[model samples]
Target: MYEWSETDLMIREAVRGFIDKEIRPNLDALESGEMPPYPIIRTLFAEFGIDTMAADGVEKMLATQRARESGTDSGGAGSGSGSGGGLEGQDSLMAVVISELSGACMGLVSALGVSIGLGATTIMSRGTLAQKERWLPGIVTMEKVAAWAITEPDSGSDAFGGMRTYVRRDGDDYILNGRKTFITNGPHADVLIVYAKLDEGAAAGADGADAVPARRDRKVLTFVLEKGMDGLTQSAPFKKMGLHSSPTGELFFDDVRLGRDRLLGETEEHRGGDGRESAKSSFTAERIGVATMALGIIEECHRLCVDYSRERTLWGQEIGRFQLIQLKLAKMEVARMNVRNMVFNSIERARAGKPLSLAEASAMKLYSSEAATDVAMDAVQLFGGNGYMAEYRVEQLARDAKSLMIYAGSNEIQVTHIAKGLLGR
Candidate 1:
């Protein structure tokens, strides 16, 4: 029953205006991977005062963290250390922006979401004060792009267990060697959050390091890497099935030397959690975000299909009069309503300070992503020959909707999380 407030509606209109002015004209170049999405994203930020707002918010959060670290204000709730509460009041606004952009250019939304939601949020929730001061300001403001690298060539869904990327202690620093593939914004990211296992075998001579865990069983650690660091090579963006504007690529680290300062939280026993826990902590948000993106895809497909059904006439009658076409439209409407309700319910829960559990988020992700994909494919079918062609844009949406099932942990992985949640695992 939750609905967008008047303010939310006003902002949505303004966002739509911005998209029409800024993104629509550049759709070809953006979709062709001919133009990176960052410049337009920055333009959107500046045009809407998002950059200013983000900068102010980050500054305030950092100041609060500083005060708490120095024992000045021991009374407040947040020191910018908790994982769940960075952007408390802006959830609805962010939902509006994400959904709007997703409908027009899902690639753009993916790039932005990985950078801010995964990259900056992870750092903010887990990094030390010095670490935050060093890396966060530019990222939150969209001045610098960030890539969160956890996926690898070998570990499609096994994540930590199959992780081959690893680090070893070297004096007070760590030497990292690994390759990360299918990384969003990896080609041009200014900052990178890399997760690697600690190779205790390399430190067998040290106390308590004699018993090295199996490679797959090693402790996972997170580190921050800057672009152009020693022995670091970022690959060119890959030719992808869809979402070309996001700049997906690979990262190769050949004995990349990382100072202790780069280690998140600067301790293996970070108060926030270890790398596995940190990454898992992001699953709920990431999954819910997939639902948001899915909703947009569903809504866009529903809108296009409805419009097309009314406009295209055959046998001296409108296609809308055909029973088969009507079925498609009805199904699209059902999907839109169901997905929108789920999104609204999530928003209401968030506003009430009751976020969904991982299992619930996973369920939302699974259903919404599948729904979006189904609706998009149906839109293509409803469009007939026009749907297969790129000119109509429905094909592009179909391709984009398919990705929602693959990333943020695949739909297959979502099932396991959902099962775990139900069984109280």
Candidate 2:
């Protein structure tokens, strides 16, 4: 039942205009990895006045928190609303920005999403007021980039349980040692949210060395690391299958000494929960985000294919006359409609403060991602030789769509989560 309001359409048109002038002209440079997304993202924030708005929002949220701490908080003044103290009643606007940018260059959207949605959002939800003040201002304003590091080489699916990256308690500090891979913005992030297992060492184990807990059983702790910290190495961007503009890479922490201040919440046990619980709480939102991205991909491919079908001719008639081509177009339209509806439903739920459960989010991710990938591939087939070439752009969309299937917990993992939700396990 939800639809884009007049204001939402106006913002979408503005975003599309920006994309035409800024993103499409540099698509080659962006897709080739010759250009990083940060500069363009920063420019976007400044052009849209997002920087000033984010700064004001953070100041207000922080003021509200301070007032609450001092027991002088009024019910309304300076109070932050909406999920995670973000702009209230602006979820649709945010979604429009994300989807529009995604349609033009998904890589840019990926970089922006991970930096704010996962990285800054985590700190906002879990970090102390001091931590939020120190990091949120720069991050929300796009002055600094942030990365959320959780995936590891051996622990692709089992992020926490199989995590090898760990920190051992030191004298009022923690010695961190481990490596993380496939980290978005890892190569250039100014701030990082790193998750590690808490290794208390053999001394704390019961019955000496025999009682030491297995590595998988250790407590998970979260920390914030800066760009140039000692013993920390951020690798050059990896050559990826798609999303070259996003700059995925690896991070190695070798005896990286972290003070208690670097630990999120400045405590091992956060008031909300431990690091594992904190990380799990983000899964639903992140998966729901995949639907929005998928919707973008689907819409772009559908638009391009429809235009192509009308123009291209064979047997002295337009290709749109062919049933086979029409089938592809029809299927693409179906996908676009379904994904758009899912995104709209999510926006409405967010506005109502009734978020979807993890299982529901997973279902959206699975269906929308598959639909996008299918639609993109079909677009490629419809274009025939043109689609195979990079110049046609369908190849890029296909590659980008494929990455959606693998990224954000993978379709295989989504199936398991959906089952768990259904069985109530």
Candidate 3:
């Protein structure tokens, strides 16, 4: 976990080579939001057999689900030696891919993670047999784009309490109404997992609603949706300061209708700790993944800054000779090392089959994001006037890095999570 294994380094080179050939040539278009990252991503997946790997993972999960249902899963008693390690390696490889991609375009990494990591994962972890079979293949293969919609126009930090989106029961069908903003891949997603509470009035009248179990008080539900569904309106991508390759947009559902089959886990009860817990768990993985993304940005910025320092002249000598320039390079190096270690530590913990605490995930996200944003800005400064120009790339990196602080869970929210964990309340 201290350094990339030889195999890991080889994979990095392969990914880097693909990026150079496919992504680098289109950098301008991507930065300008003129091109979506999917075509490039699909090429990457095809070359690396990522889709094959995803297909296999989905098959195994479904098999596991089937076994559990049949009462024949044997409870891991027959799992082969190194199966655990294989899972760990898979996690490590995903981090490597994210790191490499983020270094090139944080937007591409964000889009991929949202579609595969968050969207596909939500369905896999919380879905039933029929649901997994119906949805996971296209998602895993990149044949379909997916968006996990939880944040609404009204809910920013307070997702659950502020969520105004509601689903009203109508016989066996449900009518959904609400708007979601800041949704990744939203503008063009083929599949979506949207979160909403059963309408408050519906909740008050449903069976067991009056008793109001504390756990079910929120009564949030997750529904699988598809494009072209009646009353589902998705806006074009938003013009944001960063993540142009990752299309962010708004969704409006004016009485979009769905049946019970669309319900994740096919249950209205705590199919998985009320829907909020499901979203929170998803955020932990997303938050931790951000640290890896941050490490990539820090690594790239440090490399750029160091190269610029050694080559650029000032006062008749290389800027690297100056104490101030040295200080910036040194700090960037420190951030790179620290974030790298954070990523490796998370990998090692996962290898041991340990789950990161919510607070730990938040801490990792908070520190690494700030560090990345700081390093990118510092890189811009060290490059002088050249850095202000997008041609220099530092400007783009700086802009992209800042968005990390706001996405996933905002740094402010991260602090609140950390403090709540510390206070024992």
Which has the greatest lDDT? 1
Any runs in candidate 3 off by more than 4 Å, and if so which? 71-73, 77-88, 200-217
TM-score of 2: 0.96
Q: How close is candidate 3 to the true structure, as a TM-score?
A: 0.93
Estimate candidate 1's alpha-carbon lDDT, on a 0 to 1 scale. 0.89
Off by over 4 Å in 1: 82-86, 202-213
- What is the Cα-based lDDT of residue 265 in candidate 1? 87
Clashes of 2: 0
TM-score of each: 0.96, 0.96, 0.93
Q: Which digits, one per residue and each the tens of the lDDT, describe model 3 over residues 96-197?
A: 889988988999998888888788877777777798889888998888999999987767998887787889889989999899999999998999999998
Residue 282 in candidate 2, Cα distance off native in Å: 1.8
Model 2 accuracy (lDDT, Cα)? 0.88
Q: How many residue pairs clash in each candidate at the backbone level? A: 0, 0, 0
lDDT of each: 0.89, 0.88, 0.85
Worst 10 residues of 1 by lDDT: 204-213
Tell me the tens digit of each residue's lDDT in model 2 across 113-148.
888888888888888888888998899877899999
Cα displacement (Å) at residue 255, model 1: 0.7
Off by over 4 Å in 2: 75-85, 203-213
